[model samples]
Target: MLLERGVTDAELQAEANRIAVKVESIFSSYLAGSGDGRDRLFEAMRHAGLGGGKRLRPLLTVATGRLFGIAEDRVIRAGAAIEAIHVYSLIHDDLPCMDDDDLRRGKPTVHRAFDESTAVLAGDCFHDLAFEIIADTATHEDPFVRAELVLEMARASGPNGMAGGQMLDLVAEGQVLDMGSITRLQQLKTGALIEFAVEAACIMGRLPPEARTPYRGFARDIGLAFQIADDLLDHAGDEAVAGKRLRKDAHAGKATFVSLLGEDRARQQCSILIGQAIEHLEHHGEEADLLRAVARYVEERDR
Candidate 1:
């Protein structure tokens, strides 16, 4: 269903790589201040933030923006901002007090790379930097529109959204949860950000209201589907194959779709969600191609 936009998975990945490198360079430039603490901070930040992710959020932003005729450079700037925010979340999530995870994206977690203090500050800094990037890039032409992007991302990233979801997940660990609660937590924790990524693109691209809503919904469902696959991978995946340790969530007593639904059923749910996500694209006609491919890949990606 995807790739109707004349781009292959390999091509998408290539574009993602170029954008990723550019994003890092921009991030590095932003961090160029003279001080030992700054150096330590960047070391921890780069340790966890640089390289590894498929940069799917930013890629979605770029691709969706193109659908609305937004300039590619502007979309890339928006993507870079969100990707940085994402990296910030990961840094904090892996802290000793949070997930307590020692590794991520096939390498040592930020705290392990540097120290807990540095990691904590680095994460905090990155989140703020996200808004700066967005605001800086979006300030001209339509200031309100550009500012709206920051507001949407802040809401998604803040305590009422992703952060709140993380706190809920922490509290819910080892406690039995109904399907609704499980789904709600995952939706907020992960789906909100994915929604932001899509919405950010739409907003950046200046897509019409009606079109953006459905696409953001598509992104939300895809995010949930992607999380389900992640939960399953943790149970059935190899560390090397998955690029992160397996069975960590289980070991930590983290409640997940896999634990609640079992392997087969979790996989089934993912398939169903992917179907729903693709169905949202039907109105796009040809524009839906990239989205459909991305939805499928979310379900099937190994890492």
Candidate 2:
């Protein structure tokens, strides 16, 4: 019933894109006034963090916050913080030591466009900046809320989460990973931050922990589905549209859901997960329509 609401995918995308632009401006201004003319570092940071990608994580933050009627500006600030970490991860993920990617979001990888050292520094800067942004008083009126946001983000990005998953991924290369291991790897590498994106809204809204369970479910399922879709894209997706290289996992002999389960089975599983993800939003009513649409879009996207 709520799906019948007039909100369109285009509208959601527009809002998300708008947030992306705004965050880029905010981050750029911060960098400009930060210190001496260390212009190259700032340029590298801007290159990686600005003007690209789908901005899905930030959109999730904004969408979830909307469900609680949180201030749009506050949500945008949180989204910006989340996105800084995300972009930082991407910069590192594309490094020669990591994925060795030469292209990302249809442009040269930071390492490829700049230098390896500069790329590393840029990622490190963005990582630190994410925490600084979230901890700032401007992000929330309540100091406790800001502190909690910082703690949660640290947990999401640190050893128990993204970093741990990346370690597992590095290990999996040239080794066989069971489905369980693969699932765990993806849950940490991809799902943890996504979980934070949605859950942070609850913190920002001052919602009880109980209120996050459904959204958490939604994030977990969709996060996996999103990765599965990504696997499919890598399996046969066009590099031009994806704005990155494809089939690298196979080349590296890495394990992915698509590799473990065939295309047909992966598609089926992704659809099933999307169904589960959408069900989690029923309690949110029409306010979550955009999130529901996003779950479907994740599976259907070409890139």
Which numbered prediction scores highest in lDDT against the true structure? 2
Candidate 2: count of backbone clashes, pairs at least 3 residues apart or interchain: 1
Off by over 4 Å in 2: 1-6, 33-37
| Candidate 2 C-alpha lDDT tens digits along 1-303 | 344534676886687678788788768766773466678898888888878888788788888888899887888778888889999999999998888999998889999898999999999999988988888876545888898888999999999989888998988778898889999999999999989999898899898898788889999999999999999999979988999999999998898999899999999999999988888888777778777777777888887
Model 2 lDDT, residue 221, Cα: 97
What tens-digit string does per-residue lDDT give for candidate 1 at 1-303?
A: 443445577866676688778777767767775576578776666676676777888877776776677777777777888888889999899888888887788898888878888888999999988888888844353777778888899899888789988998989877888889989998889888888888987776677678677787788889999899989889888788777768988887877899889999999999998988887777666554565666778888888
RMSD of each: 2.2, 1.6
